[model samples]
Target: MVEVADDRYATGSGASPPLHAPRPEVEVVTAAKRTRRQREAATVITADARCTPVLVRAAIVGKARMPRAALEILAPNGAVIGNVALPNTSADFDLHQRFWLVGDPTPGSVVAIVAEGGRQIILPGSRLRSGPAEGQDWSGVACRMLGWERRVAPTDAPAGFQAVFSSDHPTIDGPGFTKAVRRFRTAAVTIPLVFFGFCFPFLFVIPRLVQSGTSTLSLLVLPVLGGGLMTMWSAHCRREVAAQAELVEGGAARWGKEIAFTQSYWASMRKPSAAWDGPMPAAAV
Candidate 1:
């Protein structure tokens, strides 16, 4: 294999890994001179507003750099118009916003969005090209990046062509609430059964046996019952531990993928890793 020297690929603490590098630069002729543009977009001005009814195609380009877990579109002057979400596995998730498209959208229009770091990015249309990054042809069917802009139908839009504003902020899960809920729901079924089966002999079953003058039989049954209950509870606890482990493992996997995706999104745009949180200047329409 041929070794290649890469300088732009290295960076700081939060720098994305190598495989997550941004798309390479494209050299296109302008005024008989070479101008290189990377095929990626970032979010800008994630506000909500009213917009004129216009139909168009679009795709989400980034999930990180998104102002919120969801993204909304704004007009050139910063008016809310539409919204959409980064697509998940099954559902067509959407952000909430109200704004309008002034013209028929094509391949290179800049869509306004609010990125994760609370700054704005006026994402350019050119970032989305025909093929995958390696193909060097970004001419694929247009689909908005997640946590970015989205297309909307005039009829499906809010009254007056305005859209609502929404987002899944604080991007990370809160206070382990989800984990607690899962533990509670699961234990609801297992805990009661364990107690009745294992500890009830010392409370009710033994007393009943003594009152009935069946102490010997009680002695024989209680031990066996107690042992079986203990075994079942132990098994249940083991399963719970395994399930919790799987959950933690899954979360780590998701976080890794998100980090990778974040890097790829900006790298595709040819932006430095710090740009995610750096200042973004306003776009001149």
Candidate 2:
């Protein structure tokens, strides 16, 4: 069997072993093919669109401690797909509806593999099971090979939508007045420039008027005028900042509402009797 250095090569006993000492030419060709397959990938909506699908490029199969583990892809399938490795842990796959496999995958298809734990692995078409019986569930066998039970409901569909709870909501600061305060704080930095602009021009003009025989009246009056200008500018900045803060609050509320709606929508579309536990037929070449 062709072997990868270190942990990648399989070492345990199995019902069927990989091809021993594959021909050099065949190995080279397979490696090239695997490289090419990793680049082709697509994200699919599965489980009645309850679960978001992620594609990947490659995978690694090995044991973590005494339990089996897998590292696979969840991105663009290509000549060399990237994969994430997950260790086996105590998690019930059956509860998560992890029994389905993409049936009859073409030469380049995305495959999702659930590990013993809650962790999942996605791999490209190059690493899939080859020469399987028609209409057989490869996901079950893959789970068993990883030392896990084939626990899946035949017709239990996932709930339709996901919820956006306040606890998990994304926020910059607090709600209500605090949000306004944050915006005002940001504006404070820029408002000073406006005040300075008026002050500088008045300082130059007032001194010229004093020297031009105005008995320095312009100098005295300019300070009061500049002060008034500064006050007005500060008010303007505060108002603008507060307006921006209102936008932030409104936006957050809108996002939260959308997420809640998505959850409810998915929940309503669930089909409790739809069975995905059946065998996934062998992929086509």
lDDT of 2 by residue, 34-77 (tens): 22333232133133312223332111242211222333333223
Global lDDT scores for all candidate models? 0.33, 0.32
lDDT of 1 by residue, 1-285 (tens): 001124454566556657767533321111111122212223322233212332222333444334112233444454434443322211212223222332223324433332222221223333222221221011111122222234344666675433222232211232332343244334433555765676666666666777788767657665677667666754454344334323333333223323323323332333221122322322211
Candidate 1 regions off by >4 Å?
1-51, 54-95, 106-255, 258-285
Q: Cα miss at 7, model 1 (Å)? A: 48
- TM-score for every candidate vs. truth? 0.21, 0.21
Clash tally, candidates in order:
49, 30
> Which candidate number maximizes lDDT?
1
Q: For candidate 1, what is the lDDT?
A: 0.33
